[model samples]
Target: MGVWIRPEVFPIFGAVGAVVGICSMQLIRNITTNPEVRVTKQNRAAGVLENFDEGEKYAQHTLRKFVRGRRPEVFPNMNKYFAEKQ
Candidate 1:
């Protein structure tokens, strides 16, 4: 038995496949790059110890990623606007 897909619909199939692949890759990257996830995986593989500060440090997502990074502002000029108002 054989099935044939219309030529016009072939592009739609390719686009859907590309979108699915991109989404899956992004999901994997987010999980793998996460500090807490890494810490948990390490703890499991090496066996948990008394001092679990590694995971504790990354327990808070905002604290773990954003505190040391750039300011979480919507617009670049928003900070200036607030500062002048205050």
Candidate 2:
């Protein structure tokens, strides 16, 4: 029984890896948002659960939306968090 990776499984493997990576990054982002998750023992923490859709709900109207911003837009404060504490 040599190592075996079925040809069809390659796409599935890539998809799963991408999903896991995105989720892990999101979780890390959520955790880093506020002091409560980092140090404070407060009951209520920062962060909101937002429900949104990509593009729009219909084709008749484009919904006049701007999807996909610059990479930096995803995590505006991530830079500060990673900055040295000097």
Candidate 3:
């Protein structure tokens, strides 16, 4: 069986969709592209450090795996510990 859309309503749907798409794109660009909505330099610096530590941890694991030619030890499943630690 085939579905049917009224030709008259199809254009209206397209017009509404275009308006919604434009508005959503504009909102996303305004939030992401504009600097005022972004994280401050201090916060970004902290984020950089956090990510660096995470990368270093992975690099260490890779070194252990290759240098010793052994499978890496699986890290224990830890509770989520970001921004929630005392």
TM-score computed on alpha carbons, candidate 2 = 0.40
User: What are the RMSD figures for all models against the true structure?
Assistant: 8.1, 17.2, 17.5
- Candidate 1: lDDT of 18? 100
**Candidate structures ordered by lDDT, highest first:** 1, 3, 2
Query: Worst ten-residue run, lDDT, model 3?
Result: 75-84
Residue pairs clashing, model 3: none
Candidate 3: which stretches are off by over 4 Å?
1-5, 39-86
Q: What digit string (tens of lDDT, one per residue) describes model 1 on residues 1-86?
A: 12576677879999999999999986785676544444465556865355556455546556556666667677859888888998
Tell me how far the alpha carbon of residue 56 in candidate 3 is from the true structure, in angstroms, after superposition.
37
Which runs of model 2 end up more than 4 angstroms from their true locations?
1-3, 39-86
C-alpha lDDT values of all predictions: 0.67, 0.55, 0.60
Question: 53-79, model 2: which lDDT tens digit per residue?
Answer: 311232223323344344535665876
True-vs-predicted CA distance for residue 37, candidate 1, Å: 2.8
What's the TM for model 1? 0.39
* TM-score of each predicted structure versus truth: 0.39, 0.40, 0.38
